[model samples]
Target: MEHHRSISDVLIIGSGIAGCVSALTMAEEGVHCTVITAGERLSYGNSELAQGGIVFHAENDEPEILEKDIMTAGWNHNYAKAVRQLCALGPDVLQELFIDKLHIPFNQRKPGDWFLTREGGHSLPRILYCHDHTGRNIMEALSKAVSEHPNITVLTKRTAIDLLTTHHHSSHMDFKYSLANSCVGAYVLNEHTAEVETLLSRYTVLATGGIGQVYLHTTNTPGSIGSGIAMAHRAGARLLNCEYVQFHPTALYAGKRGGQRFLVSEAVRGEGAVLVDSCGDAFMKRYDDRADLAPRDIVTRAIMDVMLKTGDDCVYLDAARNIKKDIVKRFPTISERCRNISVDITSEPIPVVPAAHYFCGGVLADLNGRTTLERLYAVGECSCTGVHGANRLASTSLLEGLVWGVTSGRDIARRISKTEPMSEKLRDSIRDWVNAGDEHNEDPALINQDWATIRNTMWNYVGISRSAGRLHRAFSDMRTLAKNLQDFYKNTPISKPLVDLFHGCQTAYVITLSAMRNRQSKGCHFRAD
Candidate 1:
């Protein structure tokens, strides 16, 4: 098979907030980076779909208050150090990189003053936003800056197949895992060309986003099938907390079959929008003291309880009755999305249901974003820094990405300056990818059928609530599916859907196994039995 080769200081496997922020940071440090993305566009991940905002410490907000809110939201399972770092560095990172440098027009109260918005589990309005589409605006600014950077290269529609560790090099001792030795780079598949490329880099950062697509319903992008997590796992990187999947309590209940659904921002609740039953009765107070303002896990469970008791498919988010301000002006994206679905947010209650939204657990990385593997780092939703612990607080996802992305970029820049580049001989030793079969013998229908099975199995058994029986069953089923997918992956030629399916199966296996081991009902992993 024909192939391509490239060398860089760093190879980033995503192009969302983490990838863009890190690329911009490295470019400023005069480091060369090549960003490979599965999506053709820059803001294709969950970052752009973020309708709420990014969390930050405002002038009146104290570290202790921020820490308390985060800990409470995470059910006290948060890593104190990581949470402290996020709270401390988040404001500075946003101010310096986003506001001062990139000039993202975040909604401001006045000139040079940030317009802070409140979200669930926050003691105060410490979340900064750009009107409603905070992520979109932030992404636009970062994408422009990254595109103009001469030292950074953005390769769209390139899917990462696996990490290139000592196992891939003939001269070096073959190690089973990435943690056993240093990571040189990765095997990248060019989607347009149908060719594999050996991308060798001094450092590799896995900024690929979440694993939300594992479930039947999610608020994540279609490409968010845990490809990075799967690749890192195949490289033997330590994945922690895969079981703690955060279900956003208010994804617009479009249908069970939709790949991605509109997220009714938690800010809607923060603005006094309340969850109601079909009978139009406010129901949050019966679940938690915080009511509509409780942490996401609590709200999701509460909604689930209501659904179970009422035998309803979904609950309603009534914003018109509570929100004093014009709903359309506040949430233009949401209003338009609702209008598209023939629901008027200004007058009627929008139907919503809990769906898999974020992965709190991922490849274990330190505050510096260094993974268990040497010369390899992870950031954003793909990396579990333990900041979110068992559950993520609303609006903190974007903050985590910014803080960790910059930290990882700086760490890589410092390390790469000290370490020598890969030798020509070592780089050449990484061989081309060879396909075992020439025929496209695999049935797409079978693949899709198995994919749907994986989703339904996860949604029913390993969803917001789990038991020993359900988890064990999920684990067994996923293991069998994984084996079959692995067999197919070994034989089939490289395709985006096939690659996504292969990674999704691997990811589902990891999460199911993790969920089965952790018995306690903490945060999102609630056990009914």
Candidate 2:
């Protein structure tokens, strides 16, 4: 009964760093923006769970060096243009927005000097962190700013079902699929009331973060189920590098099931922590010269190799010996989390394993964040600006989100002032979303079973180390599972849980299919065969 339609200058999906930054930036430009989130609060995404810091340049750093590090980590498959934009624009944005404007209290070594740390694949210490919970601290500042912004509105517990496009109005329309395919808004489902609303906007941005929930073990938050990517794909948006899923090298191996896993920050390694086996023997030296400092792909593969060779469930990170004194002070969040679980970091080695951490690819966009579709843009982990290439360097995700968020926000705000609002006829033509079927999914157990199957299939076949046979099998299984889900979807009432399952399946299928297409072994998507 609460079903309705609304309009805004910009409608940003996902309340992570990218979405919040975009909204705040646009609001500053006098644009009325709306941010919709799947969780109860804006801080529920992967941004808040990020343990490592944001990457930025030091005064002595050169753009070429930063570019080289990113390209090398990505195995040179990166979009040169996007990478360059990030390298050049990131520092200014950090100073102007995060430091000067927002006044974020980043950790500092001395008065007026930032406390910088290095992560894997970076040449130097160019990362500015706030203790170990860098992302959480950043999110806290962003969330507070967004809440106080007069031109911004934040909606929680809303799930975007699909994008509203011109094609949705008429099947017989002759509009070209190129730039003519514009996104006017989105159809969103209210989780609390089970009502769907048409949220119309001059520009629609998808900053829905990563697709890590499709994997069995992930360092991503629960809300990262790939809804934006799925909805965009369904609406004919071009997605690039879908195969490049970055598995973080070290996630706390709690042997737990469901929800997000605890991340062991790469900064721990930067502080001299080494990956060791059950016998306390360091082994990364045999795999790569950089050893613990190697790129995420190399490190994750090395960990997997160690686990297989040793027949152990996980490896140990010896931070106790390397970072003994300031262990609790330097990484208070990690220390407290481990202590809660009865694992004292200062006295014992932390058990860790590789887990799906970030999605390097998504709705393909330019440096300005414009996607193939007209009036539609994507940023953050959900957008493939190609800054991350085939694999992401550590701590670069937050910076990428910040840069693109500002780019998209400024561009959208400028265009909104010049462009006319969507026509009333076209808006009316976008059919009211109806759940239709009176029947519930009689067996809710089927949803859980299918969800588990998709995650397990991706983990077993399409994970860190992939093969042609494995990819093929995963593709087939996902395709079949998708069809079954589609059938059930048509007959059941729309709900957030069901939509999340549907989106997860679509994202998994895309990843598997992309992996199958790229036969060559490269960053992240490594094929042993």
Candidate 3:
């Protein structure tokens, strides 16, 4: 086993929105924090892939309208209070960024107001944006702010394989409540050095984003391996509905997007882009009255239904006819991608497909972002805080990250201030999860094959549209996949790709299980009877 070290006030996994925000917030309280990231850069997460802006109900916008829109998108089974909290606090946190934090730069909108872009679902314009790459801009702002803070340390190219636990550390201390005596630290692998090390903290936050890359195609970054949620599940956290995965209605058709034709944001549709058939015919009107502006669940299903009938590999999102052709300046990155990839907005339609985008279910948590496990707080996509329900409305992601990141940080600050640092025994317990230098099976091909099976199972059965048969098949496939991986993982040496692939495979199993258990057509989880 690798040697472990127990230190820090808080240890954060996944240095995206939640991680950055939480680190900065806690540092303000004089608490020293360490952030272990899975990539070379801070934004090397699903957060940077989001092209759309965030949703916020400002003074001019009615909160009830936002609530209704989100509830409808989530299919009404959403956590009402939590969703309401999101709606209530969203605008305030946004206001804090623009007004107090002084981050936003001439936000593109009417003078004295923030730019409100429309997306797939909302009846009114409630999205607060900073051009097309709102997520990147937001992450950059938080990352800059956090990196400058002395109390917070950012460890890049460090992937956290599993969470460190007090119970797992010592024999006598039965860590029944992980939060109370929980999360001593985490097991981190330095990608550069190719060595495993232990990181300990009073509080551990899993800000890891979506599991889109579990499929063959996704807008998510390849690093989005469901690390946090999977690690939390293994640590005895009961996961909620993991099946409700949202397939973005407008991902550029590709086997996998490593920064190529990643996505044409839904805001393009909101600006009057239309969905056209292969015959150059507009078809969305037949699907919904809102047509090009319909909610994501409706539009995605319509796209699938149309494709099924036509036997086509893809559908076209026609941006040629609208004044939105002039609006291409708003999305410079997308425009360049379109130009290089044989698409001209003024002349041709963009080929599109519904790709797995976000996972709405995770370790269930309350408003304060505290999970079932004590001392283990979750925020952002890693925690199923009941905000998204079955489907997440466009732009609510950054909102949750900011809100819960701060809230959870406040809880962490209180914990660290109240208690003494962990004992020496807890530090020793963390090193056991890592089998350092104990070389085992070295076949990369075998590990890759296991990963392929997992991805194919998720894409085929737990995909855009699912049914009882498909869900059952997916469950069975994932069960087999999980069992196979258990052996492969025990035997394989610890490599970054293998570790990421391993976590993703386990997450796929939970998602498939969640889909099979929730036998209803709701939001992104459509069950074709």
TM-score of each: 0.97, 0.97, 0.94
Mind giving the per-residue lDDT tens digits that candidate 1 earns over 151-265? Answer: 9898988999889887655353334333457788988889888888889888999999998898888999988999989999988789999999999999998655556788999
Of the two candidates 1 and 3, the one with more favorable TM-score, higher being better, is 1
Instruction: Give the local distance difference test score of model 2.
Output: 0.89
Instruction: Predict model 1's lDDT versus the native.
Output: 0.88
Per-residue error (Å), model 2, residue 414: 1.2
The global Cα lDDT (0 to 1) of model 3 is 0.79
Model 3 misplaced stretches (Cα beyond 4 Å): 1-4, 109-111, 173-181, 254-261, 428-440
Model 2 per-residue lDDT tens digits across residues 464-497? 9999899999989999999988888898888878
The 10-residue segment with the lowest total lDDT in model 3: 253-262
Model 3: per-residue Cα lDDT over 1-529, one tens digit each: 4454548878888788877887888899999998878888798888876777878655567878888888988888799999888888878876786446856653555666776777877878777777677787777777788778999888899888887666656454444344454666778888877777777777788888778778876778888778888898988766786878888888887433322238788988887888887988889999888888877778889998888999988899887788534666777777777777778877788888887777888888788787777678888887898888888888888788888888888888887888977776655444455464355666779766876777777888888888898888888888877887777678667888878877998888888888888877888888887
Ranking by lDDT: 2, 1, 3
Number of clashes found in candidate 1: 0
